[model samples]
Every structure is written in C-alpha cells, then in structure tokens.
Target: MKTTVRRDVLTLPVAPTGPENPLPPLRPPGDPHTPDERAKNGLPRDMARQVGYEPLRSLLPVRLLDGYGRKRTDTPLGTLVIENGRLRATVLPGYGGRVHSLLHKPTGRELLYRNPVLQPAGFALNGAWFSGGIEWNIGATGHTTLSCAPVHAARVTAPDGGEMLRLWEWERLRDLPFQVDLWLPEDSDFLHVGVRIRNPHEKPAPVYWWSNMAVPEERRVLAPADEAWRFAHPGGLRRVPVPVSDGADRTYPPRSEYSADYFFDVPDGARRWIAALDEDGHGLVQTSTDLPRGRKLFVWGTGSGGRRWQEWLTEPGTGGYAEIQSGLARTQLEHVRLDAGTEFSWLESYGPLSARADLVHGDWADACAETRARLADALPGEAVDAAYVAWLARADTEPGEVLAVGSGWGALEVLRAEYKLPGTPFDESTLGTEQAPWLELLRSGAFPEPCEVAPPGPTLVSRNWRDMLETAPARPLTEYHLGVAQWHEGDRAQAVRSWERGLERALSRWPLLRCLAVADAVEGHLERAADRYAEAFDDLCQERRDDGAAWTAATAALGREAISGLLAADRPEAARAVWDRLHETTRAEGRFRLVEAQIRYAEGDIAAVRAVFDEGFEAADLREGAEPLGDLWAAATGGEEIPARYDFRLRP
Candidate 1:
C-alpha cells in the first residue's frame, strides 16, 4: 500500500448534460439551457420543514484524471482548488459548486467562515440552503434556482492568463445558463470574480445574479447611503438614511439586538463595494463595477431566536454566518430582463481588508477611504479613477518604476518580496486634499456613479464597443471575434494585427499585450514573450473580460505557447512566473514541476536536477517519466545528441 506523491495536474471533468447549442451546427446538443420549461425551480411551501444533507443521490462519482492523465480507481471528492498565493479558494463542486471557503494566505485566518459540517438548513428561499462561503445566487427571486442544485464545475483560465475555478448551473426557474468564474491573480491582493448569465430563450427572459459572502458573526456592514429603501413585500417602500436612531441603518455589527434583515436596490453609494470586519482590524472587502445593483445585510443578532436559527441552519457547534450580499438588479426581488440569446457579464473583486484604523462609524465615506487607501497600497501607481471624489489625486509612485516592477502583471516579484506599496496620501490621494480641485480632470478613470439604469428593462445589454469602452477600455468585447477568428484560422500574426487595430480603436490593453506575447514567442523573443504574458495578465487583473465562453478560454490559454517557448529558451525563472500566474488564472493542464526543476537547475542547483533521475521517474506529469530530462541532461553533460522535444517547437 503506497501513497501517491501528487506532483502532477489533477483533472476531474464533469461532462455536460444537454441543451440545443444553437450557434454551432456541428456541435453537441449538451447545453442545458433549452427553449422549453425543462429546468423549473420552486420549493412550493416549505416553510415548515427540516432539511439537511441526504445521501446525495442522482450523482455518482467517476474515476479522476491524475497528474499523468492516467485513470485512477478513486472517485472524485468533488472539490477543486484555485490559488494565487494571495488568495486560495476551495470549491465545493458537490454542493452547488459554490466557494466552500476562501482564504487569504497572507493572513493565516480564513477570509470565509468554513463550516465543520455539510448539513443543509430549511431556512432558504427555495427548499433548503446551506450557510457560509461565497454563493453565486442566480435564477428565480428566491435563493436562486441553483442555490441548492449541484452545478457542473471545471478549472478554467481567465482571458488575462490567470487561473480560475469555473462553476455553472442551469437556472431551473427560467431555462437560462449561468456561470461564475473565480480568478486569483498573482500579487494582486484582490480575488477577481467574473460572472456570465446567458438567456437562451427566444423571448426576453428574467434573470438575475447575487454574490453572497458570509463572514463570521458579529461584524459591521459599511453600505454608505444618503437614503436606503427596501421592498415592503406587499405595498410601498420606506426611506431610511445613515445614522438614524430607529435602527434602520444596518451598518457594522447591527445596532439592534434582534434579527435585522435589510435589503435595498442600488444603495446611494459612490463606490460599488460593501465591507464586513471582525473585532480584530481584519476584514473582507467585496467590490465591483456595475455588476451588483443592490446591497444587503443579514443579521440574526445574539438573541435567542438568532441562536436557535443558527443552530437550525448549521450543525450543532458549527455556528452560523452573516451575509453581506449583492444583487444584479434593484434588489433580489427585481429581475433584469434579458432578450433572447443575450448574455450579461461583469467583474467582481474580493480582497482581505486589514486596516490600521478602526472605522466604527459604518459610513460609506469611511469604507471608501479605508478600502481605497489599503488597495492603493497593495496596487501602487494604478490609474485610480473612482467616483465620490470631486477630483482625482496625483500618485507619488512613478509610472515607469511601477511598470518596470512589472505593474503587477502575472507573478510580481515585489509582492513575493513583501513590500509596502505607496498609499493614496492625504496630501494628494484624497478628493478633499490639497489636490482636490483638479483631481477630476487629472484622474485617468471614468468616474462612474452607482449605475441607476434598470437592467434589461430600462437599460438593455449594451454590446457595442463605444458604450462598453466607455466603462472598460481595457478589454473590449464587442470586436473580440475579429482577433479570435484569425487566431482560430491559425494565422497568429494577423490575429496580433487585428488585436492591435482593436487596441487602437478600443484602447483595450489586454488584446495588445496578448498579441505581443504570441508574436514575441514566435520570433524567439522569450523574455519579451514572458513579459507580455505577465503584462497581459496584469492588465486583466486591473480589468478582466469574459464576453463569451470560448473567447474567455482562448484568452487564458493563449499564454501556453509562450510558457513552452520560455522553457525552451532556458528561461526557467520566467517560465515559473508564468506557471504561477497560469495556475491562479486558468485551468491550464500540463507538467509544472519539470519547469520548476529546470528553474532550480538553471539557478545552479545540480543536486536538485540530479535528484530528478532518482525520484522523478515516479512523477506522473513527465512526458516520458523522467526519461526526457535524463536524456537532455545527459546530452548537455556527456556531449550526446539532444532529443527532439515536440513541446519546445516554435511554429505557426
């Protein structure tokens, strides 16, 4: 009985069920989003019920793909990990593919509250809903049609060459396909979450998404609002403002000891972010652009009812978790109507927030200042253009120096080295500082307000480059196919030119960096290729895009050839950097340790390279199980002929 030393990539592919994949003629009808009421949602009347984990029927485990692509007799455990040194996520594929736990490694504590047990509670919008972790609620007005349904899960690469855990489930209520891609970019302190909700119906379909984050109990919520409104369930709505004594201000550790459930559509806040902090200055920040249209805070307080509900929701002693949830339209009560064949996608970011000062006021202003200051330190010299500030403040960090430190593209050495980046100073970083008057014209970003336009209804999906580029000049989705078509045609040079044209017209840096990366790799410019990969990745970290599924996957996998070229050029350090970001950015499957050993070998570690011959044969990821490395090293040392390696070839 021997335990496997896992040094290879692991793949557990869960196949598609079915749908009329309408666009492609020679494609599988395996997409679940059909034109009929095939997948419907509702728990009818389940208010009086007890729900917990059953034997998990209907889904049987299959053999898993090991590092060497060999079939193992073991059944898949239904969990996948996508880590980017800064953030780590444990995906629960078995349980609706929600993030079971999210961790910020810099701080040993778990950013998400982890459950010791896997019991479902009856206190959900549908039949049952599990508490804790980050849940992507999509579909019906309730806790989402897929809130409790098992979702298909896979590892994916993001367009900017970052690694991601992709999870999708068909909305049972409205025959729609929804996916959430969780990205962990290297060195960047935030976790980027990209979501795409597709309406496959012939008529306009009602769809919505809410990213729910559950932190520990006893936390304050900072949802800055001059006026807050919640649906009165039957009749009218109420208007509540901040610092109200009536306990309507659901900020930080709730003011009321009783259960306080607050939900509002598009709160009046300058920034699209909500925060929750524990006693210890440590907290988690949830930020987005226009993806979320509402903010919600749920609290059961420390009362008897709260304790009882907690015990009912979780297993005994497991405790409970509060939610700082976001909505796509109005509140969860309002649905964004999407036309047939239309898809809406947006980027959301989550980062570990540890502030030196305590912002107990729970105002939006305080939340904005703290998060802006902290992230500005984590990512220095980034063109910080945010709203709420009358003007933009100048950055003390030199653009050239920050860009030279790789601008946090891919795996940043500065982050690994543990350095304090410059913060938005009071002198010139804030709106009311000395530079406040001229900040608006001086800032480089589009100062966006809390996009009040109704989704689909009042404001439908704007697929045009002109409108899309107004907010996102980093990755233009409107003309992405021009480059993708050329890339698929196997003419990468033309693809690069097309992307260049796209950049000139759209000002998207992602296509340009990726185009440069492929060209550099083809021209044997491994260093530039590596840099381009990181730069493209950095561009994405700053701003990511997922217009279509194929385009997004292609964007992430484009750097594969560059990584191979770097390794062939004997630039293992650069190769390793790409691999680090790749693992965090995409579901790139290949041998990573060989490149690691090559890195060690290049760094003057002969003993480590020599050890490959002894223990490396058992390694599953090797193309020939250590034979290729052995022969290559032998050729270099004993003057023997080098073997032909297909992976190292540079071709069209």
Candidate 2:
C-alpha cells in the first residue's frame, strides 16, 4: 500500500509544439483595471492589493510558441505516475508537470478530465496550451508560458516516507524557481500535491499560482459563496450572485450563453474548496490548505461560440469540460508579493465526493453545505493543514532520483546567484545549449557572438542579467541583447538607440531591424513600421535562402509579421509578395492559410477569401479574444449565417 512514483510514456495524438517564434512579444500586458473600478465593483480588500503590481511590459526570456499547427500525430509524452493502492495520479513531466489523469482506484472512475488528444491551443499567455487534467498556472494571469514546456522531475520521500514525484522549474517571467510534488498516502483515496514557490532574489517578487482542474461540464459546480466576482470577455469585473447570475443558474454550465470566469468570494476563514458533481451527486472535489484560498469556475458556456471553442481545443466529438481552479490570491488578476528570500507553500488534496443528489441540486446554500460536509468527512481542512506542516519539514529534503529534465534556466540562475535551494536542485548538468550562451557570458565578460548565421539566442531581461549585459564588451550580439533587455525594462528610446547601433555593425541585421520595426509600430508610426518590417523580411529571406531550412522558422516568423504590417499599411501587393516568397511548408501551415485569406480579402477578392475558408484550416494561434475567422467569414459572405465550426466569437 506504500505510495510509489514511476516513469511511463503516455501516448496520445499530439500536435507537435513547433519551433518558437523568433519575434519578441511587444504587446503590453493588459491593464489591471483602475482602483476606482475595483472599489465600485465590490472587490474584497486583499483582491485590491497588488492588482497592478509589476505587470509584464514584455514576455522576455520566454519566447512565443505559435509554431504549432492543427495537424496531430501519435506522440508518446513522458509521464510519471504516483499511486498508493486507493488512488493514482499520472503526471505529464514534459508538459508543465500537468496531472494528465487522476483515477479513483476502487470506482474505476477518472477524477479529472483526461484529454484524449494533446492538442496545443493558444489559450496560454505564450501560446501552446493543451486541454484537460490539472494545470499549475504561474507567472501571470493567463495560462503559464510553460503550459507545453518541460519541467525537471525527480523522486523524493513524501511525508509518509513513500516515493513522491517532484516537478520543478525556473519560471522565467518572474525569475522565480518553483516546485510541485505529487504523492498519495498509503491506502488513501485522496491524491496529495505540495507546491512551493521560492523567491531567491533580494527584492520582492510578484507571484501568481493557480491550480486549474478540468472536469466534465455537465455537473453542478459548487463553491462556498453566495456572491462571486464575474469577469466576462471585453469587460471589467462585476459582483454577481453565485449559482444564479445574469438571470440564469450559471452553476450549470449549459445555462450560460458565453465563456466567463466566476471567482467565488470565499468568506474569511472559510474552508476553500470547489467541486463538480453529477446528477447522482458523485464526482471529484478539490480542497486545499488555508494559504491557497481562492476558488474559481471557468465555463465555456453552451452558446455556439463557446461550443465551437470547445471543439477547437480538442476533437469535435469529445465532451466539453469546465475549469475548477484554486489560487493564492482572491482572483487571478491580483498577484501576491513574495518577500525576498521567502517561499510560499501549500498542500492540495483531490478525491471523490458523494452527497445527497436532491440537496446538491436544490438551493445553492444547501448544495454548498452538503458538498463541504462531505469533503470534511473525507479529508478535513485541519488534516490538510497538518499535511502542509509535515510537508514543510520535508520540503528541504534532497531529492533521490531523477525522473525528467526541464530547461536549465534554473541551474543557470542558481549558478549565477549562488542560491542554496534544497530538495529541488538545479544541477549543473541540467544546463543545455539554451543556457550555454548565458553561461559563457557569465563566465567571460563578453557575450558570445554568432559565428555563423542563426537566430539570436533567447534574451535575458531580468535586472541581474541586464546589468551584466550592460557591463559586457560592446559587440553586435551584446548590443542586441542589451537592447532587448532595455526594451523589456521600458526604456524605449535607449532600446531604439541600442538596436540602431547594433544594426550598424550587425552581420545579421534582420533581428535588429525587426526590433526597430516593432518599436516604430508601438510609437504610432504605421507606414514607417511597415517599411522596416519589409526591409527586415527581405533580409531574413536572403538569410533563409543562403542558410537553408535552419532559418525556415525565423523566415516564417518574420514573413508573417511583415505581411501583417504591409496589410495594415494598405499595401496588399507587398503583402502578397511576402507571402509568395514564404517556404512552401510555411505557406501550408494553418496560420499562414488564415493570413492568405486575409490578404485575398484585403485585395478585394471575395472569391479567393471564401475559397480559403471552404478548404477549412485551423488557426493554431487563434488568440483568446480575436475572431479573425468569423470576421473573414462575414466579410466574404456578407450577412450569411456563419458555419458553427468557424464561429468562436466569445463576446457579444
């Protein structure tokens, strides 16, 4: 009956998460809303704190992962399973350490929504997020950048002296190292996860952590709150009554008409939990320690747009799922500050709950009480607190066995800062080619320059790295990286100067030119920006032709940007020329197909636009709030009813 952790392969039809886009994410993170709005909207006290704290100016260090397409193939993902006799948890070590499946052994029922396919969607902040299971969202409000990325995994001793699976990685957005440990007690039906986020830096760090569990939407979602803060697309937060909001019982996902987030206003000292129960009053329940108090329900409702979004995330025939989430703050919009040299830790438990069906379906208060009482009987809040305390003792225990390897950014950061992080060791060996250039820059005073043609190594924008780059010898690569860091730090004028200086002596001028183009666009110079984009695209094309397919990813990325800019500048012929020069494989991608459709639409060729849609292609990078497909359909076929598959307009 002892808990054991072992590695296994989870084979699913996975769309490959293709090469990262070379372009930097220039768009600023959405505003956290004014204080007056928070006050007027009835936001709780803690929820108001740090609402706009250290918002991201740019997603530096983390590159955009828009390269994935809709085409899927049978791919074997590495997984680690933690089982005790009563319950089993399957962890995708290669995918942000997501819990791919949680099974209640005796009942032979899956507790979480186990996705049949690994389809990378653009729900993540940095793109490439798959549906289903439990995802640990960190760094920012949206899905973590690591949604489709790997995390380092190892086997460690749990509180019960049994094997536990530990997944740890350095979150680049906030420059923090975090770890998630999954285990189950002997003969226990509930799976236990202990999470820890450490701020190794001297200054305070704004941290966000939300554990999102996907479950079948055909259930009554319950949380211990009468009033909740509802956030709909293209709107600010507003207080709404739970269960029944907007003249419908929203607890039932089908009752709503659009996608929305309902963050439960759990009262002070209330047991923090959320559950989704079927008509028979039997389903999964998640309860966590006091520190992780926030509970939320995100439903893509029964409307055509919502349903279409569901189908787009997975296969067409699969059942839809809703998210039940727990977080450190009252809402995902606010980030709690983790003080210097401090770490936040919490324990979470997942198990099946069965209550009286009538009470669960009746009055909202009665249903929440029924669910809470059942959860107390199964796994009490006090017991969860005790588990957290016990976990704290072993949080520093050195890991024993390596299960999977993630990015070496943690090791590089640790090596640079001489951090004495225990349990989760970012060993020197974990460092890879991505960390090589930084390691060289750290060791020698000079930043390594590219001898041959290749995209620039990823940029580091953290203050420490930025300071180091500032002191490095002045070379083209050094200037380029420094400019990126400066741009991320909000020094636009200096960033422009650095890029212009770098371009003067640059062998590969396209990267600097692209950065300058983005800067110009941000400064409201559209035509000038388009010209820079065109120049950059031409330079990148020359490099691709000379360097062969190694530059294909960069060429494709630059080509998309250039064409979009040209189209925006009313230069359809120029955009068409850029499209014509794209590699055939790049042109065949779903994203480019949409681009082609846009180009044709801009050129006043309605037939060509309709032809592209008739062929049907999935835009893998379809943004959360954008409705490009629906817009194109409307433009091509004026007033024609949009097909169900092409409709994903979330807002009214």
Number of the top candidate by lDDT? 2
- List, residue by residue over 1-652, the lDDT tens digit for candidate 2: 7788988888899889888887777667443222335443555565665666776777787998888888889988788999888888999988899999999889998988888999898888888899999999999888999999999998898888888788899999999999898878889888888999999889999999999999999889999999888887765678899888768999988788888888898998888899999999999999988898789999887888998889888886899999999999888788889999999998998999999999999999899889999999998888898888888889888888898999989999989999999888999998998789899999996799876778887888988899999999888888999999999998989999999999999988899999999898888888998999999988887766453544777888889999988888899999999999998888998889999999999999999999988898877888787788887888789969888878888877
Q: Worst ten-residue run, lDDT, model 1?
A: 401-410
lDDT of 2: 0.87
Candidate 1: where is the Cα deviation over 4 Å?
1-77, 230-237, 243-249, 264-269, 318-320, 360-368, 376-652
lDDT on C-alpha atoms for all candidate structures: 0.47, 0.87
How well does candidate 1 score on lDDT at residue 551?
Answer: 38
Q: For model 1, what is the error of residue 499's alpha carbon versus the real structure, in angstroms, after optimal superposition?
A: 59
Tell me the TM-score of model 1: 0.46
TM-score of each model, paired residue for residue: 0.46, 0.97
What number of clashing residue pairs does each candidate have, in the order they appear?
19, 0
lDDT of 1 by residue, 1-652 (tens): 1111011222332222111111101111121111122111221122101111111111101111111221223234445676765666777665566677777777777887776544443333333355678888775444543444555544444434444455554453354555565656566666666667766445787665678888876666655454554322122234456435364445653454555446543434455666777766577877776656677776665554455456544455675678888877544445566777677766677778776545544455675477556655653222222310101121112121110010111111112222222211111211232122112212433322212211000011112212322343333332343344344334567656656766665444655566566567757787777777667655554453343443333333434444565666677676556656554424323234455455556666766765553444222223111144544466335644323321211111
Q: Model 2, residue 316: displacement in angstroms?
A: 3.0
